[model samples]
Target: MLVLAFASSVENAVQRQLGIAVSVEMLISAKTKVTSCMEYVLVWDMPIVQFGGGIYRRRHTRIFGDQGHASPTICAYSLTRNKE
Candidate 1:
């Protein structure tokens, strides 16, 4: 529910900025498959120190990585047109 609200807010912001509304269908069809993996790197250098693990399994480790932090989560709704 929270993710849906966030997506709706983001969609509204995008529409307002673009001066046009985007169809929800378009948003649903645009989702990409994601595979998350963990890695450790220097904060400043950003070079890989370790790799090949899931964040959940390595939660105790000081170093971790996240990729989909800003990715949008979307929900689909059926399209309907009202005829008067």
Candidate 2:
């Protein structure tokens, strides 16, 4: 839920700042993961954008509840939607 919330915030920000439009087919995204403290973090250095242009990009770690490990993957986000 935290990750979803963060993603929603990011989407809202983008739509507000850049509007619901892509620039020359640019897909903005963020790396999301839940920490041991249940804190959500967005790795800005993680440069990955899905082909369909989802704001919620792939995850770098496999997290369940508060436990997670370094298992980078190009997975899909269930809590994602293509803006515009």
Candidate that would win on TM-score: 2
lDDT per model vs. reference: 0.25, 0.29
Tens-place lDDT digits, model 2, residues 1-84: 112212233444344322132233334446655333222223222222335566443454223211221212222232132222
Candidate 1 Cα deviation (angstroms), residue 29: 12
How much lDDT does candidate 2 score?
0.29
- Looking at candidate 2, the ten consecutive residues that score lowest on lDDT are 65-74
Q: Which digits, one per residue and each the tens of the lDDT, describe model 1 over residues 1-84?
A: 221111133233223321222332223334667655433221221112233542122231233322211212111111121121
Superposition error at 39 for model 1 (Å): 0.5
Q: What TM-score would you give candidate 2 relative to the actual structure?
A: 0.17
Clashes of each: 0, 0
What's each prediction's TM-score? Answer: 0.12, 0.17
* TM-score, model 1 to reference: 0.12
